[model samples]
Target: MSFPAFDAHHPPDKDLIDDCVHCGFCLPTCPTYVLFGEEMDSPRGRIYLMNKGLTEEPMNDQTVRHYDLCLGCMACVTACPSGVQYDKLIEATRGQVERRYERAPEDKAFREMIFQLFPYKKRLRLAAGPLRLYQRFGIGDKLRKSGVMSRIPARMRAMEALMPELQKEQKVPELTEPVGERRRRVGVLTGCVQQVFFSQVNSATVRVLAAEGCEVVAPKDQGCCGALSTHAGREEESLNFARKTIDTFEGLNLDNVVVNAAGCGSTMKEYGHLLRDDPEYAARAKAFSEKVRDVSEFIQEIGAVAERSPFAVTAAYHDACHLAHAQGIRKQPRQTLKQIPGMSVKEIREAEICCGSAGIYNMVEPEPAAELGERKANNILKTGAEMIVTSNPGCMLQIQASLKKMGHDGLPMAHPMEVLDASIRGESVETLLRR
Candidate 1:
């Protein structure tokens, strides 16, 4: 068998690879393995390929293909009894693949476009202008109903369909004071796509934080947290972005840097490790990382001071992989949401399985992402909930697209904070749905 040439830089750690006992714990939890029943797509199988790539074997095209298929959802890490650090191994292997492997021209172009646009808030906002116009004019709806959209590339159609109705951006202010007494001061991350598309979530987050006796500071200049690039194996690029984020948030003597987006929160928490080698930013990165917390996690930790008014809605909670699997934050969000009176938080089937919105995975790997979205949507429908509550913008978009595809777009979804914010403000669940 022919293997691709290897670059010694960013080699997969032998110790981390060895930690995978190959006892099949990760196989059942792996999305790719679940879909194709292919051993090579499983965690241990990928580790084996990483080992081969490190052992002077050519990291052939097929090897790169397997790694590309991985969602990097870290479900395997959550399932493994042995505590195998599959996250580190996969990330390191991805860096190697980017450095040593060559992709098809078209695939390379699509990836470059994503890397260029999605990680920058200004770029995403600028790009959304046309999409907003498309959605506003009902062009997308007409095209889809007439089957013309299907004629477009599947990924392109999927991208078009995934565009949420972009409203005027609700920019988070530089500082928000608490309603009563300020118990703590925190920094909020206004993510790239998040600030543009789901700014409502950020607004709700700030309101909820203030209502809970916290002073929130959202740095106007904060950029992407490098979750997308890091997950994709663009190590150097991700590191640069991480450094910028670290610098932006470090200026505030924040007791906690609150993050509402699951992927951003996960990457921010790992900033210390991502920039551990940078002499200038290493210690600062570690210090900044120590203060990072998922909004739900932070809410639960500090305790919600505001009284939650009743919100009458049956809601299915979809666990974002980064929030649940990556950060072990399954319960905090649920616990925070349950605090709302008259709210029913139903558990969906396969709650631990990824909804396949792993950063930009839905955009790049639309086929598998669509399948997983369908699976998640179906399971969500089974709960008979009026709304699906999740913590990540990616999950919100993916689940909404899947529901639309399944002819069930009537069901509205929300970030947990939105629901909580509604209850706290005595707003009806209808207001949330209408928005």
Candidate 2:
């Protein structure tokens, strides 16, 4: 258990850590704390450990483990009445961990693999080929039935199981002209994983925006927005990605940058905070951050002008943690869903709790992620909704895998944008599914 010397540059803010009154308001909302019933795992407890690590205590395995267990859902931030900035505290702490801690060799390799593969669009595309072939040839099923999957690493097995049914990737053009009078001109973010895996969600988002009389500008070469890197504490890498993303869209002179994925949107909207230290990009990043908007948020602001038809199905809307907690967007997504006639948005218990898809969390920490996923799945199933609707691709995959694991694979799952696109086009559910 070798530990690198603590780096002072990214130490947790003592002022923020001191803000926690330890009121226990966050205990019930923290998924790890609730699951483990360990004081060291709770928000207040982590803040205490952060104080120790920052002041005099040496960084050790126990300290690192507590932080590793956190999902970074920001539910505790939402739950705290004392205005403790747990999000910033956790992020800064993780940055220190990345810079000043030497993880076990295998853990380091796994993280490096994830960072290298996930943040690069082309790498993920090329990597998906073998996975798609495996799924296409029914080898995945054969391996599972033969129990060979059990011999593989837990993280690898989890990733294999959560592999989405591959679809022909849809490419968004440089510019999509609005149908009627263009009320707003917006740039759309085609996320890295979302573009490769759930490309239809981005396509649907563009279609819906165009249908609502918004000109869509989706740059073909724009790269990942650095949500995964930032969430995982690769601060320097995240800043590089943020600078590139700002450079990609800043020249378009668009009214807004629409993001359908919750995590990307949340991080994009914080570009100012991420780059505030950069002398050259500070102002530009602030301006760029201001223009970023979630699709649901943008639609609500502009009002849904497209006449929607009915899709009479009971669906539960799962709040992607970033959307609901980080971005404080709760009503807009539900409001967007309600526009379709006969669409009943049933409320699931613990809607604010994460589905254990905090970026690549389920892949990195399978045990706790699976527990939270199953907890989320059971609550959603109890709602008796025929489908699960969410805005984030990660959450959709997370919930879908959980449901399948629970033997409730019959439930359909989709992004809200997808459903809205279907209604706006008057397409049947069968047609939507086929796509």
Candidate 3:
């Protein structure tokens, strides 16, 4: 009853596997390797397993465990000196794993629940109603103090811990005119989790773009960018979302498609490769991808036209892994933040390492994700910054939870767009610190 390691459908590419020189450059930057020091958790080690799957062995529990442990942070892709495409390799490998392997019933059901809930905005909004009441009534704290939390599944506990305080939903208009002459026309991706839970971030993004003389169009019809599904290797589901996204903004004739969230931007930028097999969308996906830009990246490119008011504060800036490693967007965010009149941006140690919120990794793999989150939180504390600034909602939630555990709960966290928006609108520094 032995089976081939991979089926006839798209497996990990043999040529890409051979591109790894095994030079060990990616070892130090890998979060799992840094945490466990296991060779099996490193990128080189995973590539080795991938090679074995292709030639020597069948896909088994051990092999799949190693692959599942990957955060898909793409730090290895940034660290590799040989230019090995670990991003493509791991993506292909995960897709194969999802298709070829069967999971335990509970594991499959849990993953199914995540995929079902996370990728839809309306479902998430509906779920948020209950979460708001839980936070307001302090049920989460009561459950933990009563020791009832210990009885819950680890993944469920992790999910509960990572919930951010829900606020009133801020809706973006279908079209917003520039403050002055329109320099560029851009369409924005109001993401799923971002739209439901972190709507303020989207509102800030639109305001900042408008203030900078850009005609901003946020199509209400747009849905998930498929970042979670794509990262988790639900290939067909991801492709479907990608095609819908492409279709949403296709006829708008915009200068750029702006994405504030790092995870969504990374996956949206890869629609071409993800849909390369689709005869109808192969070319359209590539064209749509070409116009995709991270909000800070877009701001940096267009140059700042709005006046920046002074809001003096020392801030720790976290480089979201997808923005930095997956898209090579290291400098743009820093440069954008520095544009503010009196802002001081401090860098975190091990900036290249992940903060353990790679899509849903923190929820599914709770222990490792917690370890990495605490490690990142400690690094942030050393800077003594008054606030934390990052571009991704997931990173914000992960870091906030870890900092809360460390009793630094008073420290505020904000998206870079919010900071910029506050400054541009002459809001007081207290406005940001109070958040």
Candidates' RMSD to native: 1.9, 2.1, 1.3
The predicted structure with the larger lDDT, 1 or 3, is 3
Give per-residue CA lDDT, model 2, range 1-435, as digits (tens).
Answer: 222325757578778988999899999989998899999999999998988886668888889999999999999989999999898999988998898789999999999999999889899999888988888899978988999988999999888878898988999888999999999999999999999999989889999999999999999889999999999999999999999999999999899999999999999998998898899999999999999999999999988789998888788989999999899999999999998998999998988778898998999999899999999999999998878899898898888899889998878889999999999999986676544
- Give the clashing residue pairs of candidate 3, or none: none
Per-residue CA lDDT of model 3 for 1-435, tens digit only, reads 222688767788889989998999999999999999999999999999988988889999999999999999999999999999999989988998999899999999999999999989999989999989999999999998999999999999999989998999999999999999999999999999999989999999999999999999999899998999999999999999999999999999899999999999999999999999999999999999999999999999999999999989889999999999999998999998898989999999999999999999999999999999999999999999999999999999999999988898889999999999999999999988896
Q: What TM-score does prediction 3 earn?
A: 0.99
Tens-digit lDDT track of model 1 for 1-435: 223445666577778888878899888889999998999999999999988876757877798889999999999999999999999988888888888788989889989988989888788878988987887789987997898988998778778878887889987899999999999999999898889999999999999999999999999888988999999999999998998898888878889999999999999999988888889988998989899999999999998889999998999999889988899998999899888888889999988789988988898899999999999999999999888899999999999999998999999888999999999999988898887
Cα misplacement distance, residue 325 of candidate 1 (Å): 0.8
Displacement of the residue 129 alpha carbon in candidate 2, Å: 1.6
Ranking by TM-score: 3, 2, 1
RMSD of 3: 1.3
Clashes of each: 4, 0, 0
